[model samples]
Target: MTSSVLEAQKLGRKYGRRWALRDCTIEIPSGHVVGLVGPNGAGKTTLLKLASGQLEATEGAVTVLGDRPAATPARLARIGFVAQDTPVYSGLSIADHLRLGARLNPRWDAAMAQERIARLGLAPDQRAGKLSGGQRAQVALTLGLAKRPELLILDEPVAALDPLARREFMQGLMEATVEHEFSVVLSSHLVSDLERVCDFLVVLVDSRVQVAGETDKLLATHYRLTGPRRDTDRLPADQQVISASHTDRQSTFVVRTDSPIHDPAWTVTQLNLEDLVLAYMDKHTADRRAALEVQR
Candidate 1:
């Protein structure tokens, strides 16, 4: 069984009257790759920032390595973060960045950094500002990986890369995970990337945690069921409808349960990661509609 490396309780963030994130509770286990996902304006970045200690939560608490994320020097040293936009010193050369990381980070591994640079085929003297967008991202990743962190976090690390570069970056990440025992959490709007690299997923929509769990269990337990159309009065008491669509003679639904379903008239189909995400997004869409109707 995997033990949690990070835990949050009633986590929330607010700006004026707007709640950027609210009632967000999640447990992140160690030594596995996790994907953090949601649409634009969904607070994915905010959550990552809080987890990395860059932003403070408005309420509740978050702990890293069982210590508060803020000002825990030892804990901070054990975590690595590659923020969105792949931030780097514009005027610094690739070698300069590597040297700076080695000097500043207490646990930096020089040999590991050099090996990564060689693997990526990057020229050490090239100025970071002079490299292409994707190359800069690679440099940032190299810096992150060489720190020998117990937990690594990347916020939309591949959003700016071309298809080939993106694939290469993901490949490198996979190789690192297998070669070492460190855990990683990456944020991306691209579902395809998550499908390819992650064994665990945390889906956040509307600044709230919609689901967080093992990827296989989520895919295996959730199903879409279709049967004769009926109003709310006709659904089986045991069926937990996640989302629904209907016509006069037929109704389709996404439901969750651990019990085996054996209804003769209902056809059940398994959902892929993309389908599951879409179903949850649809649930939020319907909820918004209902709220607007109430206002009217």
Candidate 2:
């Protein structure tokens, strides 16, 4: 059995009275690519911050490689984070940034960093601010990769790049993960990027984790069922209704269950990664509506 590199137990962070992440629990094993998916204000950033040890959990606990996230500097060094904006000092040149990272980080690999920069055709003396958006993102990624961290977390790393650049950036990540043994968790709004590179997924909505699991396992467990309307009471307790819609003669439902269905009456269809996430988001929205009505 593979060991988990990171684990969160009822982890959470609150700002004043609002919870940024509430009861978010997940175990991420090593050597897997995890795709973090969520819409804006879903606390994706907050979760990443907590996991990266950049922010302390307000309640519960989080462990990085069997140690408290903040307890071990060595463990913290084992993780690399590319934040939402992909921060790079504008005043510093590309080479200056690399040099600083090499000097500051104990695990920085100079040869690997240099090779990546050369491959990208980035000049050492070029100011980061002078580079194009795509180039700047590439520089940030190069720095993160060269750190040789056991866990790499990227927040919207490709959001600034164009389609071609995004593809290239993901390819770079793939190569890094293949050549190096490490676990990666990257957040992106682009489902296509996640589909191409990640085998694991975590979906967050409204400051709560809606789903988290192996990508294939999730896809296998969830199904789109369409058939004539029937009493929901007939559905087994194990089958969790994620979202449901009904017309006079037809009913469609997205459900998650462990049971297998081979019946002909219900047409079972596969769901793509994007549709799967949206189903959870829609369910959350509906639940919120019901809560507001109750308060009224």
Candidate 3:
């Protein structure tokens, strides 16, 4: 098997006349909890669906666990997906779901499923439709975990949960990760939630991948530089500017570089994950404005 859990090459998915996701290229390494962060309408869900084989790409290719997604029963079985709503069969009881999982998944862990339901204090006979939203989410997550997949993709799985429920769900996920050595790609608009769990980060904006890398490496390489007003062209070529703003007397820029910044004229500050994500997102917005202006 390939070392990468998921790989997308110039992947594009269009809806009607507009592309929901386009020119996306990313390779997610195995054994890391990856966070896919973006705003609403950012194609976060589209990309996840492509990876899980729920949607076909209009252009390019996407591979999950080193094989083309949904290539065969075995390939499809290797991935577990929990969508934004944490969909569950409303008519089925929690126990019925377990039985279905066992009947369908070759690698289903019946013991794990029973233990998780018991620990969560969910009644075996409780129909999914009767459960609270959070409870239903838990049941969906339990089913995903019990499938014993090599890779799991979650698309805003806790977006509708209460704060306490969200915390509990995340806690259970972390515990399961510790117990099972599997890869996860979790999509969320909430950066704070991702900060607590993911080691790898991918920031998407306007249906494009703005930046992607290990969280620690990204944090180390990105910085905010403040100094006297200067043209962006004057900055060192190696320092890639993510965003820039200027006043009459000063210019501030967010840049990514591995080289040391020894400029005595500038004051540099380290950026947290939120800062970095916003910087890239803002840059994309600015670029769009510039493009529109040029057209006019």
lDDT per residue for candidate 3 within 1-296, as digits (tens), equals: 43999889999999999999998888889999999999999989999999999999999999888788975778778999998999889999999999999998999999999999999999999999999988999999999999999999999998999988988888899999999999999999988888888999999887788898999999999999999999999999999999999999999999999998999999999998999999988999999999999999
- Candidate 2, which ten residues in sequence have the lowest lDDT sum? 64-73
User: Which ranges of candidate 3 are over 4 A from the true structure?
Assistant: none
Candidate 1: count the clashes.
Answer: 0
Could you give candidate 1's per-residue lDDT for residues 1-296 as a string of tens digits? Answer: 37787788989999888888888888888767999888887888888888889889999898876678875667678889999989899899999999999988899989989999988889999889988888888899999999889889999999988998898889988998898789899998888878989999888887777888888998988989888886655667776777999998999999887887798888989999988888888888898899999999
User: lDDT per model, in order?
Assistant: 0.86, 0.87, 0.92
Question: What overall lDDT, based on C-alpha atoms, would model 2 receive against the true structure?
Answer: 0.87
Worst lDDT run of 10 residues, candidate 1, spans 230-239
The model with the greater TM-score, 2 or 3, is 3
Residue pairs in clash, model 2: none
TM-score of each: 0.93, 0.92, 0.93
The total number of steric clashes, by the backbone 3 Å criterion, in model 2 comes to 0
